[model samples]
Target chain A: MSAAPILAAFRQAFAEAWAGGAGALLPLGFLGGTAVLVPLGIGSDTDTLSAVGPGIIWVSLALSSLVTLERIFQADVEDGTLDLWLQTGAPMAGIAAAKTLAHWLAAGLPLALASPLLALMFQAQASLELLVHLGLYALGGLAFFFWGGVGAALSATVRRGGLLISIIALPLYVPTAIFGALAMTGGIGSDGAPMLLAASTLFACAVAPYAMAAALRLAAD
Target chain B: MFAGQGEQAKPLPVTLLTAPLLTARDLAILRGERVLFRGVGLSLSPGEGIVLRGANGAGKTTLLRMLAGLTRPEAGDVARAAPHHWIGHKEGIKPQESPRGHLALWAQAWGSKANIPEILEKMALKRAADVPGRYLSAGQRRRTAFGRLLLEERPVWLLDEPYTALDASGKAMLDAVISSHLRSNGAIIASMHDIAGFPVTAEVTL
Candidate 1:
């Protein structure tokens, strides 16, 4: 298959993420804000902070990714890009996958890159463990974005569907969040949790594109 | 009409080459949980134009969407020889995108290598090519949307209310383009309140 259409879609989506400025950086700021506020909400004790730091980072990462999901496909639908996509006769799944991947690159990746700083703030060791968690955060962030993309496509036609997207996507995020938190905290039964975290992301990679494609088709109809 | 080709060697074979580009049989559609129209059928051949005329709320847009494969008909089927250019009410123009940038994106997605500068000139949009979509007026945006038609040589064109916001000169320009497109063996199925100064093969009124 020719990759021109998919690549063009990717460029269009990625450009929009930065063109508006708010779209590209709001999630990063949100992630950083949550990382800062969590310590104040509870106590900043080193033991307490270390006990829940990684888990808190994972939760905020997932939530921050959702901040951008509601507009991912909804803007395309509103601006008639979806109809043009249908006319081009390219695989809708490919277009959906490209746009979602662009979203992950724009909104999710920054949060992952900042995870080391967030981890530092939460008293995570400034050592090799931080790098391991950084990698894990990237993978887990991708899973969250893909699953959230399905919800975004499903609600593309609904007005103010941000809440609806969160409702639909949060339940699907359970596996990744649990596995990623366990992998980070090194708690009991966490030996295979890192692999399981990667597996959850792989499963999302396998399934979310087609699900988004079907939902987008319905939205276009 | 066949005799106007001025080919005496093999007129019969030349005539046989013009097969129907689009065909629909007994198409039915609904709007807002109500049956809008049913039993609609039309055939479009090379160089033919089908104009859909009806009052407001007559399902013209729905029928066009069904033919473009954007919406499914409640009944019957549509067969198309190739992909079509569908221009709906929404111009697909992003507020932050310039006319040139919008066309460039479409060209890349449609895999059309047509010259954008030439299309910009043909559409009288050279001056406004670099202006952002939000800065463009309605007529300018409509003209930008029409630029997509020239970016690719598709066999069929399905336009919904294409003349909605065009001025007199813009309408004349569109008429000229429609005539040229018909002369080049391209079929057009458009919904409009009236067909002004353009040759039409048939009219379907609901």
Candidate 2:
């Protein structure tokens, strides 16, 4: 079977995910700000909000992952592109990874670009905070995309979406959401987050490709 | 009619001197609810054309998907002759990407390309080379995909309904192309709903 054809599928899938996600930054920005408004708008009764308000950026970023994932494989899945992709003689894992990368480029980059805006809106940054926030956001967002790929692939098969995706994906998000929040805290370095997140991210990343690919196989089957 | 010189020499592309293009045996798969196919065996010699036919859910497409290496069967040893083509209903063209760009990616992956223009002309897609796939009609898309086959010098073709959206002329064009491929002693395993024009000596149903 042809290998180039599969790579072609990968490149196209990546480009679509990136372009689609970046195209919708306005709403994502609003959502990010609202995440800030909750505690800041009400009061400081919440220690965790005052203490970990900064982490909301990752939450926003995580949701940004949800932002574009809904459409990840929908177009092609409907138009017969996914089946054609399977026709090409390449491992499904590679195809899944290429798409995940595309989602990050589209959704992750936008959140990073909007970091200063989010920081300023929340009054969360002091000095070099955007830099720290951006770094951690980049790492955490990438990890989130891996898991999202798995969700998107599985959800691609379902009839009713959104709710199911959130249900399936939300539980997984707690680990990432908590780990990401802890990682962004005031600290000298990555601490537990770097290793734990990297390891957790590793597991997510490692399993995502095969899992999504397998899901595609089942859906096609 | 368009198949190269090989079609004139023999009815089947198989030869004792050459290796069989593909071989598979004892292939099995298990899904969440039921078994898709079990103990599946397959082999195709050079220039051999095996048509997989069954009802919609009978696993024709699934079998092709597995042999194309999309999903490894749950239990089976599947092998292929180098330079095979598995064309499904996808047409595999990106709506945003132009025809040449789409074919260029295939050329890069399949290790075949004489000249883009010559190939497009052969497949009658030279005029649509610059257009994105979305703008093209269903026939044009299938033509462009078949153009990928022409540009790629592979010997084995695994096609699923190579006849989906083609006009009568387009169907004739496809039949001639496969005929020519066989002429060159290359094998084709096609899963088609309609197969009146081409020669199909074997059938595998799941």
Judge candidate 2 at residue B130 and give its lDDT: 90
lDDT of 2 by residue, A50-81 (tens): 46566767766777677677667666676666
The TM-score of predicted model 1 comes to 0.95
Which model scores highest in TM-score?
1
Model 2 misses residue B127 by how many Å?
3.1
After superposition, the stretches of candidate 2 with alpha carbons farther than 4 Å from their true spots are A1-10, A18-52, A74-76, A83-91, A187-195, B1-19, B23-43, B52-59, B66-79, B111-114, B193-195, B202-206
DockQ values for all predictions? 0.41, 0.29
User: How does each model score on lDDT?
Assistant: 0.87, 0.71
Model 1: per-residue Cα lDDT over B73-143, one tens digit each: 88999998645788899888877788999999988876677799999999999999999987999999999
Candidate 2, residues B53-95, lDDT tens digits: the string is 8888777887877787766688888786454666778776766
Give model 2's docking category.
acceptable
DockQ result, candidate 2:
0.29
What is the Å distance of residue A149 in model 2 from its true position?
1.0
